[model samples]
Target: MTLTAIGLAIAATFAGWVASLGPLPIGEAREVSTTIVDRHGKLLRAYAMADGRWRLPVHAATEVDPTYLKLLFAYEDHRFRSHAGVDPLALGRAAVQLATRGHIVSGGSTITMQLARLMEPRRQRSIHAKLRQMVRAIEIEHDMTKDQILDLYLTLAPYGGNLEGIRAASIAYFGKEPKRLTLSEAALLVALPQSPENRRLDRYPNAARAARDRVLDRMVEDGVVSDADAAAAKAVSVPKLRKPMPILAPHSSDAAMSSVKNKPVVALTLDAPLQQSLETLAHDRAIALGPNISVAILAVDNASGEVLARVGSPDYFDDRRAGQVDMTRAVRSPGSTLKPFIYGMAFEDGFVHPESLIDDRPIRFGSYAPENFDMTFQGTVPVRKALQMSLNVPAVALLDRVGASRLSSRLKQAGADLVLPKDETPGLAMGLGGVGITLQDLVQLYSGLARLGNVRPLREIESRRGEEREPERLLDQVAAWQVGNVLLGTPPPENGVHNRIAFKTGTSYGYRDAWSIGFDGRMTIGVWVGRPDGAPVPGIAGRTAAAPILFDAFARTGKLPSTLPKPPRGTLIASNAKLPLPLRRYRPLGELVRTDGERAPHIQFPIDGSRIDASGGDGMSAAMPVKVAGGVLPITMLVNGVSVGELDNRRQRLVDSPGPGFARLTVIDAKGAADTVVIRIQ
Candidate 1:
C-alpha cells in the first residue's frame, strides 16, 4: 500500500475506537422539568431540577409557533432538512464572507451541530472542538430522527441565568408559554440564546431589543414575514424583568410533589380557577383579620373525595404568622366542630330523637363543668334546637352516655387522627374542644356526613384509570340525615343564605382556634382562622370569624350552593308527642325510676367540695379508692369530666391518682344519670 493509504487506514481504526465509547455527555439534556398542573392541565407551579436550571419539556416544530419555526430555519439553517449534519453551501459562503470582510460574521453550524455543541459544552474555542462537534452531530443524525434533533435544540438552548429552552424563556419573560407567542415575542426568543447574558431583557433591555430587531429584519429579508409585520414586531416592547411562574395552590403543590417524587408532570385534583380565586380571597381577608393571623381553607368533592382546592395559609412567606406551617395538617383544637358527629352517633344509637326533650340547664360531671358559649343555658329545649344553637351542655350530656372513647374510636375508624394530651384518655371535655385535631381530618369527617356517613379517603391527585378504592362507613344513613337536617337550619352568616348547606362552627378554649366546616350535596368546605404559633386572639370566635369566610368560599365557586338531599327512610321527623315515649324524653338514671323500682344509682361518698389526702403516692393522682354507694353495676368514674376507669357492682373501686389539686369526682350509671362531687386531692 502507498504511505497515504496506510495513514488513512490508521485514522479510520482510531475513529472506530472513539465511536465505541458511546454517546457524548448530554448533561441533563433530556432532564424533564417538574411541573404541577391542575385538573384542566393549567400550570399551578414549576420547580427546577437539582441543577437549578428550568429545562422544560419541548417538542419539535409543532410545539413552537409555525412563524417562529420558519424564521428559525431561514436565519439559522435554511437547508436544515437537506443537510446530512453540516451544510456545505452555508460553510462555503461563510468561508467566502470571512475572506472578503477580513472578519467572521455568520456561523456555518446547522441546528443539529448546535445541539451537539450544547450537549457536550466546551469553554475553549478551537478547531479541535469544532471537529468534535461535527463528528458528534453526524453521530446524532444517525441515531435520532430530524424531529428529535430539533427537539433537543429547542430544549437545550440557554436563554439567561438558570433558564434553558423556549418554554422557560417565554414564561419568565412574557408570562406565557411558547405555543402562542406573538411575532415580536418569538423574535425575542430566537435572538436570546445567541447572547444570553448580554441580551437578557431583565438586565439589558436595549441590547435585547437590538438583538430582537436584528432577527425581525432578517425575517423580512428572508421573505418569511412581511415588511409591515416585521416593523410592527420591532415596535413591541420587551419585558424588563422575569415575571413569576404560576404559583396557585402552593401548599397543595408542595405536598403532591413530595408524595410523588422525581415526577416531571404531576397532575393534581385542584381546579385552577377556583384555587386562584380562593387564594386571593384568603390573602385579602387575612389582612383584614388582624396581624399575625393566618387562614386555611379546603374544598372537597364529597362524592369522589377529591380535594378541589386547599389554601394552607393566607401568606406562605409571612414569618409572623408562621405561615410556612400548613395549618390544614397541623394539630389544633377543633372546639365544637365535632358536636355534629356526637349527635349523629346518638341518633344512630337510638339514644335521642331530633325532637327529644333534653335538659340544657346547668349540669355538672365531676369538676369538669361546661357552659354554653354565652355563659347561659336554655331551661329545656328540643334536640334539634340545642344542636342548631350549639349548646355545650346538651352535647356533653349526650357524649357522656355515648362514651368518649367510643366517639374517638368512631372518628379514627373514619380516617381522622386525634391528638390528645399526653397520657390522658378521651373524656367528656373532649366533646367540647379538649382534644386536638387537624383541619384536614375535620374536613374529612364533615365530608363523610355530606356523603351520608360514607367516608371516602381524601384524594389529592387526579384519578388514574383502573384505580380501585372503597368507602368507609362512619354512621348509618338515618343518623347522617338527622345531623344534616339540623345543621342546615343553622343561622346563615351576615350574607343571607340563598341555598341550603349544612354547616357547623367551633371556637376553641380561650379563643386559640376558630373553625367553620360546611357541606352540601356535591362539595364540603372547611375554614380555619388562627395564629399558627398557637397564640390566642381575643374575640376570634368561629361563628363570626371563620363562618363568614366559609360562606364566601362557597359563593365564590361561581355556582349556587347545592341543597342537601331529603331525609332518608327511618329518619324520625315527628314532634315530641308523636315520637315513642322512650324517644320523647332523655331521662338520666337518677332523674327517673328504674324497672326494679330502685332509685337510679347515686354517689354517696366524697361529698361536693370535700378534701381528701393522697400524698402517700406520686404527684400524678390521689392514692385513694373512690366510693360509689348506690346505682346500677358497671358504673364509670370520672376526674375532671374525663373517664378514669369503669366500676363493677362493687361499692368501692380503686381510682386513678389525679395529683395534688382541686378535682371534681363524678359517677355515671348505665342509664346516663350522673352525680358529681368536688374534692381536693393531695
Candidate 2:
C-alpha cells in the first residue's frame, strides 16, 4: 500500500511538472515583413524582417490556394484536423517502421509540430528537442484553431535562403502570388520546406525536381491527384533562377514606411498598374535622355487630391544618376512653371484681361532685367498670347504688377513650400526660376486650377484621417478658369494633340531642370527630368525633354484626356476692344520715358521714404492722399501692385490705405510711363 501511495505521489509530481511547463510560445512576438500595397491590395514593395527573412503576412484560409493546402495536408499531416497535434497512429507507424527497418523511415512530425519547431528553433536535432516539440504542438493545438495553425505554418515555414513564407517563395520563384498555383507549382511548394536549402530551385534545380516528383508521387498514391496529373507535374521543368521581388514605387514605399509606425501592412492611394506603367515610362525616357539623367513623375486625382501614382526616379538602383533620390520632392529651380500662377494672380487683381495687349519687350525691375527665352521679343502681344508663349519678360512684368511678396504668400497659403535664397525675399526673378519648388507642390498647385481654385492637400496613405481644414484658395474661380483657358491653348509638342490637356513647360536656368506639368478634368500630372545631382544638361529644354514624356504618361493612363473646368461665373469673355479702356493694355510700373516735352510719371505725395498716419486711430485704415505729376492724365493708382482705381481729375486723389507696414504706391499714365514709391503706412 505504501509503494502504491509513492507511485501515486510520483504521478502527481509528473503531472504538476508538465503543467508548470506553461503554454507554448505560439503567441510570442515574431517579426513580419512590412508591405506597402496599392489601393487594390496589389503588392508594391515589401521589406524584409529584422532577421533578414521574407516572412510575409499570410491568410492561409483565403490568400493561399486550396490545391496547395490539400497537397500539404496529404504529404505532411493527413489527420491534421482530426488529431490534437501529435498524431498517435502516425507516430506508432514511424516507431514500427524504425524497428522493422532497423533505421528511422519517418519521424512523423505533424504540421503543428513543425510549426512548433519553427517557433522555437534548435540547432542540434535530438530526442529531447522532439519531445519538447510534441509537448508544444499539443499546447499549440489547444490554444489555436486549425486555420490559425495553418496560417502560422505558412508564415514561418522556410522555403529557401532569406525566404520564410509561401508568399515570398512564390514571388521569388514564380514572380507572382500563390493565389492560383499550377499543379507543378503546387507540388514544388509542398516539397520545398522539407529540406529548403538542398531543394532550392535556383541552386539545385535537379534536386528540386526530384523532391517535387516525390510529392507528386505521394499525392498520386494517396489518390489526392490523378496519375496523369502527377506525371504532367513531374514532367514540368524547375525554375533555375530566382526573380527579384516586386519593387515598384520604391521611394514611395520607403516614405510610407517611415511615416507609418508599427504597422505590418500599409495601404496607399496608389494604383499599381498605373504606377508600374509610369515607372517603365520614366526608365525608358531617362535612358533615352542620355547618361546621368533621371526622370520623376507624379499623378494626382483632381477631385479627391489622392496621389494615384508617383515615380520618384527612373531607376531606384542606378547610383550614377542618384536614382534613389525622390526628385518629386526635391527643391530645385521651377523656371516658368510658376508662370500660370502669376497669370492667375493678375487675372484675380481685376486690372488685366486675357485679351488685353501686353508688350513682351525687355523689362527691368531695379537691377533685374528679364528677357524672352529666344533672346528676342514679341512687341505688343495680347495677354493670352504672352502667357501661352511663356514669355519671360511678360511674366516678370505681370509679377511686378502683382506684388512678388503677395504671390509668394498666396502660393504658401495654398500649401506650396516655396524656398527662397538665404536672406532674399520674393522678387521678379522668381517668375523665371530664381526660387525653388518641388514637383509635388507644383502638381498640387495645378490641381487647384483643375479644381476651379480650391486646393486639396494630396493624400497617399489610406489610413490617414482627413483633417478639418479651411478652403485652400489658389485663386478665385473666374481667375482659375481664365488661367486654365489660357494654358489650354498653349501649343503642344510635336505629334501631340491640341486642346486636350492644359500643360505648361519650364526650363530652369542653365537647363539644370526641365519641367512639364499638366491637368485634365480628373487628373494632374507633373514631370521633372534632369540629373538628380543638379548638374546642368545643356541644350535640354523643357518642351523637348519633358513635354513628350508628359504626353506619353497621360496616354499610358489608359484614358483619354478629360476636359478642363468650364468658365466659372463672372469670367469675362470679351475681345481686346470690348474690354474697358483701363484694361485695354497692361502698363508696367516705373516705365521711365521722357520724350516730346512729356516728363515721366512720378508720385508726389506719400513720397518715397515718407511715413503716413493712415490708420484713423481706431485700428482701421483711413484714406491716404496721393498726388502725381506725370507725363499723361487719367493716371492709374496702384497700392501694393494691385490696381485700386484710376485717379480722378486734378491729377490728385485720396486712396484707401493698404494694411500696415511698407506699401508700394505707383501711378501709370495714359502713355504707359509709370512711377512708384514705397511709403510706410501707420
Candidate 3:
C-alpha cells in the first residue's frame, strides 16, 4: 500500500478503538458542588460535594474574569485556538529543550491535553501516559467545542486541598467570584493550579507569592499586561488564609436545600446585600440587648410575596440564644401586633370608620377584660387614633362585636398559622396577643395589607417551580386602606423622621416578645426581639426594641418608603361630618334593642354547645372559664342553677367542671334577660 493509504488505515483503526469505548460519561464527569445563591446569582453559601471537593460550575471564558482568561491563554498555550488539541511545534520545542537541558522544561500540553488528564486523572508520568493523553485530547477536541474543553479543565483543575475550579479558588482565597478578579488575584489563581498542593496561599504564602510573581512576569513578557501592571500586581500581597464560603441567610439556605436536595445551585428570593445587612443589624442589636437576647427580622416584597431577607437570629451558632432555631417560623405571642387585623375586620364589617369615634376606655365582655398596653386609656378617640395607639380596650371592644372566632377564622383563611392554647376557644384576649404566631406569618399578613388586602404565602426560593398560589382576600380594599392610613400616621422612631410606612408595635404580656410590623407600597418588614427561651426580658417593649430596628432595616435596604395605593372606590376619604351614620361612630353592641326592653347576654365563650376540656393534661384539674358579651353590667352566671359566681369585671371566670360530664351554663343580666347553653366537659 502507498504511504497515504497506510496513514488512512491507521487513522481508521484509532477511530474504531475510540468508538468501541462507547459514549462518554459527560454528566458524571462534570459533577459540581452544590451552591446557594441570591436572586441575582451571587453566592450566598456553598457546600462541598460527596468527594469533599469544591468543583464549582465553570463556563469557559465567560464565567471567569476576562483578565484571568487572557493571562491563562497568553501563559498556558499561545497557539491554543489554531491547534486541534495538540501542538506539534510546541512539542518539538519541548523535545529540544529536554534533550539539551538534561531536564524537562515545559510539558507543552495544551489546555485540551490538561483537560484530558483531569478527566481520567492518572498521576504517573511516562511515554505511554503521554501518548494516551495525546489521543484523548484529540478525541475530546473532536467531540466538544474549544469552550467546552476549557470548561472541563476549569471545573476539574485542582486548587489546593479540596478546592477546585477558578470560581472556587477565587472565592476561597480572595473572598470573591472569578468574574471580577483583580490583576493580583487573577495571577494568583492562574499560578496555583499548576502545583496547587505546594503553592497554596493559605498554607504557604511565600511559595504562593513566588509562583504568582512568576505568572505576572510571564504575562509581562507575553504582552498580556504592561510592565507597570505586573510590578503593581507583584506588590499586592497574597491572601494568607482561605476564607470560609459565604453563609449568608443560613436559615433560608438550609431550608431551601432541605426542601430540594442535591441541586447544583439553588437560587432564592433573598437579596444577598439586604440579607447580609439585616444579619449585621440583627447581630448588632442582639449584642446591644445583652446575652441570650436575639433579634429576628423578615422583609418581603409586597407584589410577589417573596421574602427578601429572613434573619432568624443574631448568630446561627449561638448556643446560648438557640440561634439555630428559625425564630421567623417560631410560634410566639404576637402581642398587640395583631390588633390591626382586628380593627381591619371591624372596618370591613362597616362597624367603624377611620375617622369614626371609638371608646378606648377600660372595657369588659362578660368574663373577659381587655386593658391598654399602657395602664391609662385614651377614652373616646378616633378609630384611627385607637388603632395607631394600639389600644387593647378598643381592639377588644371591636373584637367583641366582630367575634374572636370570626377574626381567627379569617386569619387562618388568609394564610396565618395561629396557635391557640390547648382546648381554649378564641377569646377577646386574642385581640391582645392571646394567640401564638410567627414573624413570617405577621410579615405575610402585613404584606397583604401592603398589597391592598390580597394575601399570599411568602416565597423563599425564587426558583421554586410550584404552581402559583392565588392570593386570598384578607380584607376589603377600603378597609385595608383605612388600616394602612391609620398605621402610616403612627409615631416614628425617636429620630422623629417618619418613613410614612404604616406600622404597629406590640409588646407581649410579661415582656416575653417585642414585635413591630410595618409596610409601604413595595415592601413589608417584621421585627422581633426577646430571649429565645421565652423568658421575660424586663423593659423590652416593641416601640423601644423592635420598631427602631424595623425602620433602620427599611433605610438600609436603600428602598424609599413608598405610599400605599390610593383608596379604592368604596373608601371614604371625608371628614366625620360628611361621613354616613355608620361611618360616623362605632355602633353600640346592643343597638338593635329586643322587644323585652332588654338586650340578651350572649355566651361568647364555649360557643353555646362547644365542648370544653377541663383537664389541663398536667395532672391538674383546670377550671373551665365562661365568658359573656352584649350584656348589662353585673351579670350573674348559674352553672346547673347553683349560682357558681357573680362578677363585675368581664374577665374570664374559672368555674369547677365538677369532673368531665354535661353541664348547664346560664348568664343573666341585671335586666332579668337570660341566655343558657349546655356543654360537655372532657
Candidate 4:
C-alpha cells in the first residue's frame, strides 16, 4: 500500500474509535419539553418557561400529508439520509466555494449529524466529538432502527432553551400537537432547528416557506418523493395556526405531576377555556380588589372530573413552586364549603329534603354550642330553610345522624382528606365547615357531589401524547342528582342569571375560615375567602360572602349547561303549607333556587331586607359599608364586619357597652337572599 493509503487506514481506524459518545447540549441541561392541551385535545399552552425546553409533537410520519412532511424535509435536511453523519457532497460543494470564492458560506454537517449533536452535548462536536457521535449513531442504528432514531430526533431536537424536543417545538410554534400539523406549520417547524434563534419560522413565514420549497425540491431529486408530488406539496397552502397557546398559570400546573411523580408527562383533567376564563376572572377580580389583595381561585368542569383552573395567589407565574406553601394542595378548614357535600350526601342518604322539618333554633353539638349568623334562629324550619340560613343546630343534627365517620369516609371517597377523630371528629362543627381541606380539594369534592355524587379528579393541565384517562366514579349517579337538586339555587320557570347553580356555604368554627362550594349541570366552582392563619373574618358565612364568589365565578365562565336535572318521572310530593321555608339574606345569584318555573315555588321570599320598596332602590352594593352607628359604639373598627380596632364614629363615638354582638349593617336583596356579619363601632 502507498504511504497515503497507510495514513488513511490509520485515520479511519481513529475515526471509528472516536465515534461513541453522542452530542447533547451539556452546560445548560435542557428544560423538560412539555405541551398542555385542553379536554378536546386542543393545545392550550406550551410550557417553554426557560430556553432549554422546546417540544415538537410527533405528527405520524405517514400522516404527514403530501406537501407537509416532504416540504419540511426538503427545507431542513435535503441530504438527510444519503450521508453517514456529515453530508460529504454538501461539504465538498462548500469546500469548493470556500477555496475558490473565499468565505465559509454553508454548513458542512448533515441532518443525522445535527441529530447526533443535539442528542449529545454541544461540547462533544470536536473531531473526537464527531467520531464519538458516529460511534453512538452506529450503535443506535443497530439498536433503535431508523424509525426510532427519527422519532427520537424529532422529540429531542432543541428549538431553544427549555424546548428539548420537536413535540414541544410544534406546540411552541403553532400551539397544537404534531399529528395535527398542517403542511405550512410542519414546514415552519422543520425550518426552525437550523438557526432556532434567528431564522424564526413563527415570525418570518415567507423565509420559512422558501426554505420549505427548497427541501421539497431536494426530496424530489433524492427520490424520496416524485416531481409531481413535490410540485403538489409545494403548491399546498400554509395551515392557519389556531390561536396562540396561553401563557397562563405557567408552571403552576406542573406540580400536578409531582403527586404521581413517575410519568414524563401528566395529562390533567382541566377545561382549557374554563381554566383560562376562571384565572382571567380571578386575576381581573384581584386587579379590581387592588394589587394588595392577593387572591386564589379554583374551578372544575361539571360533567368531566377535570380541575379547570387553580390560581393559588394573584400572580400566576411568581415562584410557581414556592408561590404556594402547597399550591392549592394543602387542606385547611373547609368552612361552609363542607355543607354542600354533607347536604348532598344527606339528600342522597335521605336524611333531609327541601321541605323536611327541622329547628333552626340554636342547638348544642356536644359542649360546642354553635351560633347562627344572627346568634338567633327561627324555631322550626324546613330542611332548605335550615341550610339557607346556615343554622348551626340543624346541620349538626343532620351530621350526627349521618355519623361523622361515615361522612368522612364519604368525603375521602369524594377525594377530600377528611380525617375523623376516633370519636367521629365532631362534624356537627364540620357541618359548618370545621373539617380542613384545600380549596382544590373542596372544589373537586363538591364537584363530584354536585355531579350527583360522581367525583372526577381535576387537574391544572392537559396531556399531549397519551389517551384520556377515564375518571374514577366517586358518587352514585342518582345520589349525586339528589344532592344536586337540594343545592340547586334556581328552580324551573324563572331561572335567574345564575339559574343552573347548586350551591352551599360554610363558615368554620369561630370565624376561622369561610367557604362556599357549589355547582350546576355544566360546571361547579368553590371559593374560600379568608386569612391563611385561619383567623375568623367576622360575620361571613357560606351563603353571605363565600357563596357570592362562587356565583361570580360561574357567571363569568359562560359555558354552563342550559338544561337542569329534572325531578324523577312521576316523583311528585304534595306540598304541605305547614312546612317552613329556607330563607337567607342576600344569597349569591348562583345559589338562588329558581322556583318560578313550571313546577317552581310560589311566593319566593325576598332575600332578607330585600327591599319591599313600593318605591324602588338599587338595594346595596356587595361592597356597601355596614357599620354600627348608634349611641352605643363598638369597641373596635369593623373589617368585613369584624371589630378589629376601637370604633371611631367621629367625635360622636358614644361610650358604649358590648351588648349582644357589635352593632353592624346587613344587606339582603329583593329576593330572600341576605348577608350579614358583626362589626364594632369604628
lDDT scores in order: 0.84, 0.88, 0.84, 0.54
TM-score of each: 0.83, 0.87, 0.84, 0.60
C-alpha lDDT of candidate 3 relative to the true structure: 0.84
Better of 2 and 3 by TM-score: 2
> How would you encode candidate 4's per-residue C-alpha lDDT over 360-473 as one tens digit per residue?
656555588877666787888767666666667777776765557667776775567774445655446667665667778777777776555556666554542234344545
Q: Order of candidates by TM-score, top first?
A: 2, 3, 1, 4
RMSD of each: 9.7, 4.3, 10.4, 18.5
- Summarize candidate 2's per-residue lDDT along 1-682 as a digit string, tens digits: 6999999999998678778777666545356899999999899999988778788888988788999999998888989999999998988989999999999766689999999999988988988788888988988898889988898899889998999889999999999999989999999999899999999987898999998998888888889999998888888898999999899989999999999999999999999999999999999999999999999999999998999999999999999989889999999999999999999988776667899898877766779888888999999999999988999888988898787998999999999999999999998899999999999999999999999999999999998847525559898888899999999999999857999999999999999999999999999999999998888999998899999999999999999999987787657799988875667888765546655878877778877889888877678878888888765777888775466778877788889877788777877677666676778887
Per-residue C-alpha lDDT of model 1 across residues 1-682, encoded as one tens digit per residue: 9999999999998688667647766546777678898988778988988878887877755567876787788889998887889888888888898999999767788998899889888899888788877888888888888998888889889998888888888889888778788899889888888889998888999999999999988788778889999989988999998888777888988887888876778999999999988888889989999999999999999988888999999887888878778899999999999999999987776657888989999888889888999999898999999998999999999998777987898899898999999999999999889999999999999999988998988888874523635787788888888899889989989964934778999999999999999999889999999999899999999999999999999988989878887788756688888875556778753364567776665666676677787766454444577777666666767665455667766767777667777666766666555566667776
Best by TM-score: 2
Candidate whose lDDT is highest: 2
What lDDT is obtained when candidate 2 is compared to the true structure? Answer: 0.88
Q: Once superposed on the true structure, which residue ranges of model 3 sit more than 4 Å away at CA?
A: 1-23, 591-682
How much is the lDDT of residue 183 in candidate 1? 90
Is 3 or 4 the stronger prediction by lDDT? Answer: 3
